[model samples]
Target: MGKCIICGKPVDGLICEFHEEDVVFEFEGTSPSQLTPGRYYRGTVDGYADFGVFVDVGDHVTGLLHRSELDRRLESLDWEPGDTVYVQVLDVRDNGNVDLGWSIRQADREFRGSLIDAPDGEYRPGERDAEDESSSADDDSTTADAGPSTNGGDATPDEPAEPAEPAATPTMEIEEPDAPLKRTTVDALDDQVGSIVRLEGEITGVRQTGGPTVFELRDETGTVECAAFEEAGVRAYPSVEVEDVVALEGEVERRYGDLQVETETLEVLADDERETVATRLEEAIEQQARPETVEPLADDEAVAALENELVDAATTIRKAVVEARPVVVRHSATADGYVAGAAIERAVLPLVRDQHTRDDAEYHYFERRPLEGTVYDMDAATGDVTSMLEARDRHGEQLPLVVLVDAGSTVESTDGYDLLEVYDVDRLVIDDSHADEAVVDAVSVAVNPTLAEANGGAVTSTALAANVAAHVNEAVRDDLEHLPAVSYWEEPPAAYVDLATEAGYDETAVTEQREAVALEAYYQSYKDKRELVADLLFGDERDLAAHVSEQFRDKLEAELETARENLETTSIDGVTVATLDTAAFTHRFDFPSANLLLDELHRRERDDGPFVTLGLGEDELHVRTTTPVDVRELGETVADAVPDAGVRVVGGRDGHVEFLVGERDSVREAALDALAETLA
Candidate 1:
């Protein structure tokens, strides 16, 4: 055997058939020559690193380039594999494995590389491949091929297993049948609310927070809760997904907290049959939409950015949470309006827990502007401050000034104005012990002094340190001091106040008010606040936070707009703007809608695990759990549901879901229904 191809050895009898082939494409190292660097080549991208793309050209030989090798000017381009690109050979020292090269796509147009040269080695046959096949064939014939043996490959005594049940007729349609109650179409059934009629729908949600998987299963009519044990729940649909549409048979049992439509059975549709169901649902939703029109609110890129911004906003709100603090409670009469008296939208600055009532404030006001001789009365039992006109007598109109103060407390204007003397006005003896301790704690500082017409009727000598009015007319200034335009200090945030009192904290300590974010953490992490907000807002996906953000913005914008407009007309003379610095109500805005959507999506499928949100476009919407929610199907579904509705479709971020028109509610509904059908 002068020329035996297998093993490259001369042999005669029982020759191995491998190690022989017409051509052998072998790679040796990380060089260009080792690769089939043509316009198009096949290989695995084994590893990806921050530095470059690691390609398994073959034979465990990986060539690392600044992914730029695939397309040299990579920094200016977006490239992803399996994308087409050009390459050329440079060096391959170790046989044909080690390779180095440049991108043909990145090379100059004038530099036309030559074609690959064929090797000079003569034709040869290989026996290794055939031997491998033979061995593999032998292995395939073993019992293990069926799967791993249960008893160490040893067969146990065969036990008589029960015969499997016969398959039911394929076209099993779970339909709603008409009864004596009413023969109404589901569209018509809604009007017959109290009627006991059959309604067929697939399960949409299964929230088993504590025990069994309890979820709402709905169709054209409505949703109902269905519960099952752990075993039966898992066994019902081994392949059940979030968007699987399933038919259920149940009865309506509506009662607070127990409102549910019971289901006796849950049947899954076959894969081939689901397309038709999804298609039908899609058609229905489209039917409800404005079929021939849609306007893009924002592109994919814009929406992504908006989503990131939302998360940051939410985080900022969270950071603003603060512990409840001391506040004064006083009752005052609601003045006759027309004056649209004392309007301050920021009155309820921070929200306390619902278990407790919101902070209430009271301010005494003179009906007409005071002409310097205005006297007020202080009720001893109530600590109520009132003017002489409200003294309950006309001839004996002498007024008693109510003095309320906590000792050693200080109150001064932002301009460094002290008004301790003003709180020292004479008390005309309304009650024997009118100045009580309860009154002192509530009023931080008070000024009740007998002027005795002192030296030209001037005020002097402060009674307390904080009471600037007593010494220098410390009236704590009126609401007018901090009006539409007030000094920054006049209304500093609680956090900023801490900064103000701190040794070296001031406007210079933090960024400018306009440039600053409410959250210190975000500011600390992102050096550039504007860039951080823009980057997070413009280049991200809409997640769960985005949805909440949308709700928050929608609500907040409405509230703010209304308040701002109303404030323009209403005059609030006594509202202390600086008092709002300590208020924070972030937690009150919690809406479980986002979590609920995610939970619902998860219950429909086992793998979905928990709720996860992704921003598809500018909106943070639930992923369409249902399959085949293409644009066409979406239009159809909208059309069917609301015949002439102006519809806009958006791809889902989390699941394979499709949303309806521009209207948030309809889109949510269509997507949820589609999910029901998909994971039915």
Candidate 2:
């Protein structure tokens, strides 16, 4: 008999049956019945299909490799007809159909031994001389529990090692039983610095720096960084990736004030061992990291109904942090949007720091993106998918949890949410906007005032987000309590104002922070500007908020002064209607975006006898008024009066309406006439 390559146990051939499926074999059989189920075989690519690829395992036997069985995209495969490839026979149906699974090993040398299918339902060496009289049928399962061995014999009991050649799967080196070293948790590494330690964990992130490949590993207790230096910029352990369960041998060392492991050896665990470790880690995390019930931020009737969803949103975010998945926050580009997004960022960064040992964990784990408009569209979703998929492929990072704040409440966002659902990425929407009923179905969690039967007008995205943020990380409640006040453009909610006052932010400071964030939000629009935003909103140095606020006031005042000079007024059915040619009077490209300028202009004009500010641009008209105007009603009236205008209430909740300027003069005249008729 030949000995099993692993464990040095005597078997029928070079490898035992327990490791039969572990190695790639060349099948000489000609029929599906002759194929051994679960054994990987060298196959030839026969053809491709939309749903799968056909591979010829033998002259007459063919198997289907379904796209679902592929590790990556089917289109990514470079195989052509007749190309030699490797696939596993997952099953052979009684009808002579074979199902195939992708095999990671492509080279013949990666596995030990070659087995031939025998008509007697046994596996034997292709060369008869390789088998001896000592071989027996019971050898298959007899040595299944054996540790790794080599060609000559097993290594010395004191220093167990892997075979010189690559095995079907890399496994941990069997340590000497007498020289036992217990596995250490990451949280205990602080005390174990400068000492050799063994650790079992999953690789949460893998990054190749100039000198070392840094693997961010997380156990049930905590997370730590392990560095494996093979050569400068060269990838060490090409088979390992994020989410891989591993048994690592290393020395805990201090690097630049942080604890890191200098890896001596790292091994990816086998399937069964990996599952056991993963299940244990998951159970431990679930026990310790489960979110607790959050006390309501306020007992307002509007907030009461949403208490459950608020808790759920916070819970989802907390779970993502514990699971090492990045949280992506998408918000509108307005002051309200930025403040809401910033509040979530504030809550999440601290949790990331507490959970991870990496100093830059906050940046790596949390990101905030500002959207162009109130709708989450396909363009934005496509960009997010592209970037995140690249992160998955390059670093093996888990898919991110996409949180939409101040947006994603309408049917317009359905397509975007659908795209995300295809990848099974979790989504959360926190907004106070008027929502379509279908929106709740599109996201994992929908925390909206409208859905909870609360008055949407009584809520703002900042209020919803700030409350969720507070519950997400209670330590940042003091920092986030002032955010809602900064989001209001007109009447700040009394509750938010009272809360801000208690937090020590007076009226002026709130205004300054609001203006500063709005100004900064306009510049980048895309980037989160994590540090810059933190400084502007929460910093005391350089009077950053004060400085940006001053700039905001100057620009806004100058624009308002110029706008008032050019404003023309008329009485329309008892309502004093104000009109400004935004295309002519306003600096469309300068400080204070058209939306902000128009909001302020409308606010200022409303003091005089129920006024309305109609800022007419080249192809669009934005309507804002102090007089209570049913925007949807007025839009329908205008559309009826001026059929060519195509007017509609685009922002129903904000009392904002839009219409095409196709017939600009006609549209304006019709809008004025419609308002006059309504008021009359």
Candidate 3:
């Protein structure tokens, strides 16, 4: 009988049943069947395979430590061949194969006491000494026949055999190699499959999958995926993140027809090594992200005039993708806004796919969100901030770059821009509205023809975005050739019309596509609906556009008929002023929104003389003027004339103002009287 080393309780072996897991055993037997299941054992690493590592428990018995049984990724283990490790025998199959499970306690000092599992029985270190002394004394009579002692001491027939020295504790010492490994580039890895190499670069992305964590490593030459495992579905190295400079050693292998590196050792570079790699990546990215020239999709004086700003905006978007920063696009909820946002989306998705190794990279890296109005207000910015912060906190992602299309050009969006600035987020604006000069100074890049004083007639937001998209990725130029014409409600420019015709879309086809997008844009004012929008704009479903357009015309014509019956017209200073009480006569929440109905009514009722259309709601009023009217100036004049009405301009780009609902009649009278004097 023996005592349990942990509790000092009397037992039949060195450990009791309750403390068997506490002590690690050294397997002294030579066959797989000798391994006792649920007992921890010391072993040596033999080699590696794709599924697991082979370990030699003794001279003749070998076991497999499968990747699934590891607490961390198999590749992340730094153990080389012949190195000592600790594992538990999970099972011994009938075919003489032993299965091993991971052991959290790896070192000899972690256990209560080390013991040997021999064919006879288990014994502690001191017990082995007593057995050696007994053997030498008992075998003295056979010394003459044996003639020599196996022990390292002289023995003669006349002299008694000496006791063997106290047996020493078994230990292993590993030596580190004196030479450093050779470094290799990602581009050169294809020729070195099945060979181990070292790499130094920046991590562009990190994604956790069902099996391993895939880190996208980028060098000056190219990019590749390096996989590391700590456990099933667990992150291999939690400290490493995107944009971190790293030195990695791994074996190059092919997985699912794509080249992947199985990481053996990964360390975040420091000091001089980090600086050298960072500078090289910076220089390469700068040269690749910026296009040498900006080429317009078609010959238009307006687009040519703002070439420099277009290039700058395109470069900013391209650099965001290369750096693995998400791109969030915000645009107005209108046909022109949808077309503009979709054009850029079409160009950016291809680049995201090329840069990332993940299958869902396009959706993760690029997003398009539609705004309720043509302003990036605090509500919109708050939603964006919440989502972006969540992504960064949960996934270790970099903050995104905000891109505004057909919006964010006026002073109302300054507060939203300021909120993003607090987090050091980048912003880019592309619009055709009369941009406020303050907006130009707030964002990183602003592309507006009005800022450049270009005289080309009626430059729509879609026109500007399409040219920028072409420059961002010229491969998608043919896909965007017809978008500019679809954004125009009336007669488009001759150049865009010809371009659309050459792309196989006629005038009717373009109009149908525009109307369909506008209807879908109204239903879900905030969601992206990427797939549905793509089908409407670029898909081959002709009947889809036709069907949606039919519903758009039906809904619009009915609203127009009801509005014309309620409209009241009067002449003020030789100008026709048409007014409709939208709150009383219109469907406030349904399709053919108050704004769309008013636009159609004005187009049908206008004459050669000066004309103005007004749609008055409970608390707001929409304005449309044949001549240029500064809505801001008009609101100031009316507010002063009717002080009790509390009138103020709420939306400058959309030409709308707000007032107290209680004094709706008084505000209406005062606004008309103010308009009479201004027109006169």
Candidate 4:
């Protein structure tokens, strides 16, 4: 018997079975199932497919390197049909199909040690006699007489053996009781740099880059990035996930002015150890996240009544940043929605930079997605879930915390919320819409005016988000104080107007930022345009905001002029009803979209005496009134008057109604008659 190289335990071979899988292995097996999962192997490119690439691990075993498992796209791969590549055997299916994963290390020498995977398990190259075979020819000129006895005693009868195993694995002793380790907190790591340190903490984040897999470990004191690598793009500790309480042993090293632990060994704590660590982390986080006193941004009774919910929303965002969870802010593609989303983005990005060591942590941890509509429908939630799942599975990223700003309030978003609920992804909705009461209870934190017993008409999403943003960080309150005023299209709230004026933003400047953000929100509706938006809202120079707002005014004014020229007015029951042929007059595809143009025209040219500006289009009839009109009531009126028009209240926030294009004339005539009778 020989001593196991790693644990120094007496065994049949030099290495034990427990540590055998830790080293890289060379494949000598013929069948695909014979190969071990989570082990790297040399492979040759067999061919490429539209979805993925096929690689031959050995002569008879071929595995598929799925495109989803790649760090880059399949088209970017430079490998030809015959090029050799290194891959990790992710799984060996029961049907003898091998699923291969990408490896950054192209050479075997980059790994710790080499072994051969056999039918039993894994072992050294020459350990199994049946697998190791060599022969000497006449031209080889081997000495018949033994010079130094090169063959070991384990050699076969017909063949000579190689030398005894060399010392490759480290010498370690396994005691009856585990050895006690000297542990230190993350805050004290700076003093232990370049020295071996053991840390007990929770894994806040796990990210697999092209090189090492970085685990953001957090203790009560602070957080540090621990990088563990078996091979590139391969999970170093596949069993360890985010939120796991682990005890990691490594040497603390500083890279690029940041402290990183070069992990040598990591173990997930269990039972007592896990409970102790988790309890300590929870206590610390609770104290840090909850402020002793939450000071409301404004002295309004309505805002004060929502103190608990606002604090909860801020705490959720702060905790998400501290834990390295990606924060996805989904908002409507409008001035108020973008402002609300940008307020949270401004607060969270600074916290993200402070919490994580990654330079692009803001981009990776926070995403502001401008939704096409004001509802978090299933389509939007499905897309978000798919992208986040891909990021988690392929890149080892933590599942994100979705922050619904000005969305996820109505009953229509319930299905979308349920989809995210299936993944157990934490969601927080900060809106001022007329939300279904069920939606308020469905989310982790819902901060809506309707839920707070406040009139939803007076509270805009930007106003609510700005209040929450102040409590999220409190440092960016001045930067975001002007945002609430920018969300108002008509008469501004006195409090928000005063707040903006105090923060050096006059009515014109607030209008400029509002119009600038609205115009920019249309382009790249998919992306948040972080830098451009930051410049427009929080930039030092007002010139950029002025320039963009000039474009906004130019386009909106041109559309308004066209609408005025095409205005078709009629007196019905002494009510001045103005109608605009939206299809022929407005620039359908250009800036100041249909809704914006109609809002502006209705704001500008509507006469008194219960004015109604009806924007008549092919498929939609958008209504704007000088007085508050219950949309559902008007929809019922129009539908009763014109049964074939199929008029429906499609938009709740703006009193928007829709009708069939085939019944446009009937719908318009009935709408005019309904307005005349109601006014009379």
Off by over 4 Å in 4: 1-181, 188-191, 207-211, 231-234, 256-258, 455-457, 639-648, 653-655, 676-680
Q: Write the per-residue lDDT of candidate 2 for residues 1-680, one digit (tens) a residue.
A: 77766557888655677887767766767668888788888888765543567777775567889888999987688875657898999998776778999998886777665555544434545454446433643475466646445645557568756647754776889976667578989889889989999999889888654356778788987788898989755678989988889999999987534689999999999889889889989887776554565665655567777988998898889878888888999999988898999999999998899888765567667888889888888998998898688667655578899999999888778899999999999999999877778988999999988888885357789888989998898888888888888888768878778888898888888988999988988886877777888898888763889998899889889999999999988887788888989889888778878778888888777765667778878766677766556666777877888776766665454444566756788878877887777666
Off by over 4 Å in 1: 1-211, 216-224, 228-241, 255-259, 271-276, 287-680
TM-score for candidate 3, residues paired by index: 0.72
RMSD of each: 33.4, 18.6, 13.6, 13.4
lDDT for model 2 comes to 0.80
lDDT (0-100) at residue 439 of candidate 2?
88
For residues 348-394, write the lDDT of model 1, one tens digit per residue.
Answer: 12211211111110111111111100112122222222223222121
Best model number under lDDT: 3
TM-score of each: 0.19, 0.68, 0.72, 0.72
Rank order (by lDDT, best first): 3, 2, 4, 1
All candidates in order of TM-score, best leading:
4, 3, 2, 1
For all candidates, the clash counts are: 95, 0, 3, 0
* Inter-residue clash pairs, candidate 4: none
How well does model 4 score by local distance difference test? 0.79
Query: TM-score: which is higher, 1 or 3?
Result: 3
lDDT tens string, model 4, 1-680? 77766678887755567765445666777777688677788777765543577777776577889887999977578875557788999998765667889888877677666767666655776766643333444324465533344554345567767656896998887869857678898878878889988999888777664356678888876678898988744669989998799999999987535678999999999999999999988888777676456876665566777888999999988887766678999998888889899999988888887776544456667888888877788899998998888667654577889999987777667888899999999999988766678887679999987787874247788888988998888788889888888999878778778989999999999999999999998776776777888899999999999999999999888877878888998777777888998888877777877878888888887776788888888878887777766565677887888888777775354446688889888888877887777766
